[model samples]
Target: MLLAPENTRFSFALLWTLATFSGFLLSLLFIEIGEKPDIGVLEATVGGFAIALLQGCLLKQPIFCIRWILSSLLGWSIITAIGIGALGWIVPSTEFLPLRILYGAIYGGLGGLGIGLTQWLAISQPMAVVWRWIFVSSASWAIAIPFGSVVGIILRRLTHLFLGEVMGLAITWLVVGILTGINAHKLRS
Candidate 1:
C-alpha cells in the first residue's frame, strides 16, 4: 500500500499553480491599495514567494524540493516569466521587446545563489523573511533581476538580425540589479 497512490494525491505543479493563483489575487490587492499600477522587475520574484505561502494550508511545507537549486529556479523562473510578461502587457513601451529571454541567465544565476543560501540555512529560515512573503512582493526580484537581465546579452548575440547591437543588456543588468537590490533592502527593514 505504501507504493500504491490514490487520486487524492496532488502534483507539485498543481500545488504551485494554486499558490500562484492566490498570489495573483494578492497582486491585484497591492495595486488596488496603491491606487495605481506599477510593474517593477522584482515584482514577480517576490510575488512568486507569496504564492508559495498558500502551501501552508495544504501541507507542512518548508518542505524541501530537490535540495535547493530547483527551489531557486522555480522561484526565479516563475517570477521572471510572469512579472516580465505582465509588465510588457500592462505597461505601454515605446521601445522594448515583449518578452525578455535574457532574464533566463539572471534567473539561473540568482536562482543558483538563492539555492545555495537556502541549502546553507537548510530551508529553515524564519517566517518573517517567509517563503510566502517572497511570492507576492518584489523583494526577491530586487535581489535577482540584475542577474536575470544578463540573459539579454546571449539573447542579443543569438538574435543579431532583430535586437541588433543597441539592446543595452549591460545597462539593463546594472539598473535592474541596483534597483532590485535597493528595493529588497528597503523591504527587509
Candidate 2:
C-alpha cells in the first residue's frame, strides 16, 4: 500500500477534530435523559462514532472502515463505562493544577488504551509499527486532556462563559487529532 499523502493526514486530523467536537456538543443534550454514568457512556459512544466515522474516511483501505467505526464505538463505550464505575476511587476531586493534570493523564491513558486496543484490530500494519499506536494514542490524550482542561478553566474564569467547556474540548480534540494524525501517517507509510 502506498503511503497516505501529507494533505490526507491533515484532512484526517481536521475532520476528526471537527467531528469529535460536534459529537460532544450533541451528546450534551442527553445530559437530562439519564444518570451521570449513563450520560458519560452515551457521550463516549457518540464521540467515538463521530470520531471514527470521520477518521475512517481517511483510511487508505476502504474495506476496514466499518470495522474501524464499530471498534471505536465499542472501545469508547466500554472504557467510559469502566471509568464511570471507578470514577471516585481512581480519581480524586481536586482544583490543584498539578493534581488535575496527573489525574487527567491517568484517565486519558486508560481510555486511550481501551480505544487503541480495539482500533488496533482494524489497522493493517506490522506489530512493531502498530504497537506504537497504542502508546501514541495514550500519550496524545494524556497531554491533550490536561492542557485543554487547564485552558478551559482559565478561559471560563476569565470570560465567565457558560459553555467554556466546549472550548476546552475543542482544544483537546485538536491536540488528539494532530498527534494521532502524524503517527497514523507514519504508521501507514
Candidate 3:
C-alpha cells in the first residue's frame, strides 16, 4: 500500500491512470512493433516500478517506494502467470464462451486476492480495513474479466485482431485500476 499524504487521492488516481496508460502503450509497442512478448513483460514490469516509485514519492515514503517496486514486480508477474495458467487448466478445450469467461473471472479474482493480500501485508493495516480493501480489489478484478472479453471482442471486430486485443487488455486494466483506486479512497475517507 502507498503511504500517501492527506487530500492526494485525486492526484494518486491521475498518476495511476497515466502510468497504466503509458504501460499499455509500451507493452503494445513491444509486442506489436518489436515482436516480443518477453520485452512486453519487461516493459510492463518497468511501468509497475515507475508507478510504485511515483506513488511513493507523492506519499513521501522513499523506503516504501523501493519495497513497492519490488513487490509490484514480483506480485504482478506471479499473479498474472498463475491466473493465465489456471485459466488454461480450468477451461481447457472449452468451446463454450460463457464457461471460458467464468473461468477467467475465477482466476482473475484469485490473482487479485493474492495481490491485495500482499498489499495489505505491506501496509500492515488493520485486518478489518484490509479485508474490505482486498474484497474491493478482488471484486473489481473479477468484474474486469467479462468486461475485458466484451471489449476485446468488439475491438477485434472493429480493428486489427491482435492490436485490438492488446488495447482491450490495457483498457480493462485502466478501468479496473481506476475503480479500485476510487474505492480505496472511499475506504480511507
Candidate 4:
C-alpha cells in the first residue's frame, strides 16, 4: 500500500518511536542499573547507533543518512558521558517523585541539546528552517523523560513488574519520536 504525502509524517513518527524503543531495549543488554561512566557510554553508543541507523533510513539523501548516524553517535556518546559524570545514573524511586522528574528533565534536555547540535552540523538547510529542531529536540526529551519516569514508577509499584523502567523508556521514546518526527518533516521540506 502506498502512503499519501501527509501520511509520511505519521510514518516518520511511528518509525522513530519503534527505533528508539528498540534502541533502548538493545542498550539494556549491556547496561547495568548503576552510575558508572562506562554504562552511560555503552547505553548511548548502542542506543544512539540503533536509533540513528533506523532514523536515517527515512531520509532520501544517502550522504545525509551517513552524516546523521555519525553525528548522532558522537553527540549521544559525549553528552551521555558528561551527564553520567555530572548527574550519575538516575533511577526513579517512589520516595522522590518530584526530584526524579526534575532530574529526568534536566538529563533529557541536556542530551537533546547535544544530539541536536551535532545533527545540526549535518543538515544543509538554512538556519531558519533547521534551528527550531534544537529547541524542539530539547523540549521533546525534557517532557518525555519525566512522563516516562512517572509511568515507570507507577507501573513498578502497582504491578510489581520487573523492568518496569523499560516501559518508561519506551514511552519516553514514543514522545520524542512524535514530537521530533513532526519537526523533522518540516526540516526536510
What tens-digit string does per-residue lDDT give for candidate 2 at 89-181? 122235477886887787777777777888888877888777898888878878877776677667767889734545765677777777776
Q: How do these models rank on TM-score, best leading?
A: 4, 2, 3, 1
* Colliding residue pairs in candidate 3: none
Task: Write down the TM-score for model 1.
Answer: 0.33
| Top candidate, metric TM-score | 4
Q: What ranges in model 2 sit over 4 Å off? A: 1-38, 84-94, 186-189
| Candidate 3 lDDT | 0.55
Write model 4 residue lDDT over 111-138, tens digit each, in one string: 7877788889778888876678888887
The better-scoring model by TM-score among 3 and 4 is 4
| Model 1 spans > 4 angstroms off | 1-3, 6-12, 31-49, 61-99, 108-116, 119-189
What is the lDDT of every predicted structure here?
A: 0.37, 0.65, 0.55, 0.71
User: Whole-model lDDT for model 2 versus the true structure?
Assistant: 0.65
lDDT tens string, model 3, 75-161?
555664543432110112333558747865876688667666666644545678778878876787677755665566567668856
Model 3, TM vs. native: 0.69
Lowest-scoring 10 consecutive residues by lDDT in candidate 2? 84-93
Number of backbone-clashing residue pairs for each candidate, in the order shown: 14, 0, 0, 0
Stretches of candidate 4 off by over 4 Å are: 1-4, 29-38, 84-90
Of candidate 4, the 10-residue stretch with the lowest lDDT total is: 84-93
What alpha-carbon RMSD in Å does predicted model 3 have with respect to the real structure? Answer: 5.9
* TM-scores for candidates 1 onward, in order: 0.33, 0.78, 0.69, 0.84
The C-alpha RMSD of each candidate to the native structure, in angstroms, is 13.2, 4.5, 5.9, 2.9
